[model samples]
Target chain A: MNFDLVAQLAISGLVIGSLYALLGVSFGLVYQTSKIFHLAGAIPFAAAGYAAVWAAKSLQLSIWLSIFIGLAAAVIIGVLILVLGYFPLIKKKATLLSLFLISLGLSVAFPNLLQIVFGVDNLPLEVYDAEGNPAVPFANPTYASGFLTITKLNIVQVVSSWLLVIAVLYTIKKTALGRSITALRTNPAMASAVGINNKVVYLVVFSVSSFLMGVAGILITLQFVANPTMGLQWTLIGFIAVFFGGITSLGGSALGGLILGLLSSLSGIWLGSQYAPIVTFAILFLTLLIRPQGLFGKEAI
Target chain B: MKTTNLILNASNINGGYGKHQVLRDVNINVGAGEIVGICGHNGAGKTTLLKSIFGIQPLTSGEVVFKDKDVTGFNTSKVTALGMSFTPSDRPLFRDLTIVENLQLGAHIVKDRSLIADRIAEVMEIFPILAERRNLLAGRLSGGQQRQLSLGMALMVQPSVMLLDEPSLGISPAVVEKTFEIIKDLAARKGMSVLLVEQNVRAMVKITDRVYVLRNGEIVLEESGDDSRKRTDWWQLF
Candidate 1:
C-alpha cells in the first residue's frame, strides 16, 4: 500500500473534480431550465479558450484582460446561438428532439470551423515578447507540503469553481431572479401566467452557463494548452457529472463531479489512468440500472 | 350575446395541436366582475379556448380584445402583463415552492417589493389557511388547500381578468362548494372578471353569471347562469 501515491492521487482528483464541478453546473443550469441538450455549449467553451489565446497573442493584453475578453465572447456567442438558432425554430413549434439535433449539428460543425480558423495545432495561452518568443504571463507555480504537491493553477481551479458555484446556488435560493428561474423550471405555463418572459430567462441562463464554461476552458488552458477539440471532451465530462449527481439538483451535480474526479483518480492505483473513463461509464451504467434517479435526484431523468 | 363593460372577448378563435384542430370559430366574452363558465366534456376544446385567449396556446386565427385593445397573438407573458392571468388545471401551483414563494412569483412582473409583500398579505387574508401554512411547500398541501392556494396566487397580481381551467378538479364535494363560494366572493369583492372552464356543470353553473356549453370545438348553447341552473339536460349539450 503506497500511502504517498494514494495521497497524491487524491489531491490531483480534488483539483480535477473542481473543474468538473464548474462544468457540471454550467451544463446542468441550461439543461434543467429549458431541457435543451445544448451541445453547442462546446462552441463557447472552445471559443473562450481560443479567444483568450488570440487576445494574448494579437492584442498583447494582460492575462486578466484577455480572460475577461474570453468570457465576454463566450456570453455573446451563447446568446447568438439561442437568438439565431433556437428561437426561430421554437417559434415554428420545433420539438425538443429537433432542437437537440440542431445543437448536435452546431457542436460538430463548430470545432471544424475553429480548426479552419486556428489550424490543427494546440495553442499555448501565452503572451509574446519583443523577441517574438512565447512566454506565460501567469505561470503556474508549484507548492508542496509534506508528500503532497499542488500548483497555483490547481488552487485557483478549486477556489474559483466553488465560489462561482456558491454564488449561483445563492442566487437560485435567495434572489428574485432565482425565483423566476425556479418558476420557469417547476412550471413553465404558470411562469408565463405570472409574467415571466421565458425567452429572456433562457438568454440569461445561456449567458451564465456559457460564462461558467468559459472559466473552465481558461483554467484548463492555463494548466495545459488550448485545443479546438477540447471543449466537447470537457463538456462531455460535465454532463456525465450532471447525470451522476442528479440532473434535478445543481448541488448534487457539483458533488457528483467531485466524487467522480476522486474515483477516477483513485482508480489509477489499481487500473491505468486511461481506464478512468471506463470506471465512470460503469458507474453510470450501474446508476441507470439501480437508482436511475441519480444520487440526489428525487425524480427520474 | 350582450355584455356590459366587456373586459375580455375572443372572436373566431381557431387553434389546436399540429394537424389536429381543437377549437373552431369559438367566441366568448366576459363582463367586468362577471364569473363566466365554459362547461363541456373532455376533448371538447374547453381548455384550448382558455389557453388561446391567455396566449399560452397559439391560435391559428383569432382576435382577442382585452380592455378594448386587440391583443391578437400576444404571448402569455404579454397577456399577463396586460392584466389577464390564467391558472391551468394540472399543476396550478409550483409544487416545489413555499406558499409565500409561490405568491411572490404570482406578482413576478411587479418590480416593487413592497407591493408584492402587500399583495401576499392580501392573499393571506383571502386564504387564511395559506397564511397558516405560509412556509410549507405547495405540493404538501391538501387538494382543497392547493386549489385555495392556486386562487390565492392568482389574486396576488390583482388581475382584472382570470382564466381558470378547472376549479373543481381533484377536490371533494364539500371543498368544491366552498371553493366556488371563495371564487364568487373574490370576484364580487375585487371586481375581477373570471372565465373558468369546467366539466362539473352542476357545480360551475351555481356560481357563474353566464354559462356557455361547448361541443365539438363550438359553442352549442349560451344562456344566463340562472337559465342554465333551471335546465337539467347538460349531458345533451356536452
Candidate 2:
C-alpha cells in the first residue's frame, strides 16, 4: 500500500517487461511463420548468455566482441536446429506434435550438455584481467527520477526492445522478406505457389528469431548471471507473453510481455516473488477463458 | 495447334497424395496465347493436374517440359523462375496483406525493382478494382475483387504459363464471365498460356480454346472449345 513502493515496482516491471517483449518477439516470430512450437528455442536463448559469458571469461574478450559472438552463436545454433533437426522431420512430413516432441527433447538435452561443459555454477558476465582474475568490464550507471531508480542498462533494455520490435514490425510491413514472411504466415500454400521458397524463408525466420533471443539472453545475463537452467523459464514466460498478447500479431505478443512484466512486478506488493509465475499463468488462463484471441489478436490463430 | 508450338506439355504424369493416386498418366498441353480449360466434377483431379504441372504437387512419375526445358520434379520456386505461375483455388492471395503487398509477393523472385514496379502497374491496369483497393487488405475485398487480385498477383510474374485452379470457385456468375474474358484477353495480349481448372463447365467452355475433361485421374476427353460448346451430352464426360 506504499505509493513509493508501487511506483518503484512499476518501473522495475517495465524494465523486465521490455526483456519479456524481446523474448516474445523471438518466440512469436518462429511460431507464427512456421507453426513450430520451438520449445528448443530455449537452447539458443541460453546459449547466447553462456557463450557471451564464456567469451568474456575464457578469451578475455571485450564486452562488445563477446556480445557479438554470443549473438552469432545463437544464430548458428538456431539455424542448425532447423537444418539438422526440424528440416529433416519436415522433409519426412512430420506432424506438428512430432516436431514439438523433437524440440522438447533438444530443449531438455542442451541445458544438461551446457552443465557438463560449464560446470554447475552460475557464470556472471565478466572479463578476465591480465592476471586471469574476473572483473566487471563495463560500468552500468544508475539514473534516478523521483522515487524511482533505473540503470543505463535498463534504459538500453527498454529502448533496444522497442526498437527491435518496431524494426521487425516495419520489416514485416515494408520489406520484400517481410512480405514473404507475412505471405508464409498468412497463406503458406499461396506463398509456395508464388515461388516463395519455404526453406529460405524458414532460415531467415530462425536467424532473426535466434538473434532476438540472443539479445534477450545477453541483456538478462548482464543484469544477473548466466546459468544452464535459466533458458526454459524465460522462454516459457515469453511463450506465455505471446499467448497472452495473442499469437496472431507480433506486436500483440510484445505488448503482452510488457503487461505480463507489469502484472508480475505489481503482484510482489501483496504476494511473494515466488507467486509471480502463478500470477502470470493465472492471467494466461483468464485470457484464454475470456478472450482466446488475445487482447490485440484479430482472431484465434 | 501444332505440337511444336506447345508452350507447356505434361506427359505421362502419375501422382497422388501419400499412397492414394490422384493423377494417372494425365497428359495435357497448352499452346502459346491459348486458354485451355480442365473441367470435371469434384475430386476428379482437376486441381491435382494444375498443381502437378506447376510443381506444387509432386508427380509420382512424369515429365513437365516448359519452354523446351525439362522441369520435371522441380519445386514450385524453380518452376516459377522458369516463367510458370500457379494460383490455388482457395484463398490465393495473402489475405492479411494489402493488394500492393500481395502483388509485390507475386513477383518475389524478381530481383529488378523497376521490373516489379512495372508489373504492379500493369496488373493494376488489368484489374482496376485492385488499383482502387491497392491499400486495402486483400481479405477485405469482395469475392469478385479477391478473384481479380488473385489473378493480378499471378500476372505479376508475367509468366509464360499460368496454372489457375478454379477461377470461378467463389465468384458470382457475372464475375465468372468477366474473369473468363480477362483470362482470354491476357492470353491473347501477352501471348501467355493459361491452363485453368474449373467445375463451372459452362463458364470455362466459353473462354477456352481447348477443353480437357478429367474423370477420377485420367483425361476422359479432349476437344476443341468449339466442339465442346456444341455438345449437349456433358453428363457422360464425367
Q: Residues B65-129, candidate 1, lDDT per residue (tens digit)?
A: 99999999887777777888888898899999999999988888778999999889988988889
TM-score on alpha carbons, each prediction = 0.96, 0.96
TM-score of model 2's chain A, to 2 decimals? 0.97
Q: DockQ (Cα-based) per candidate? A: 0.75, 0.88
Residue B23's lDDT in candidate 2: 90
For lDDT, the strongest prediction is 2
C-alpha root-mean-square deviation, candidate 1: 1.7
For every model in order, the fraction of real contacts preserved is: 0.81, 0.90
lDDT of 1 at B161: 96
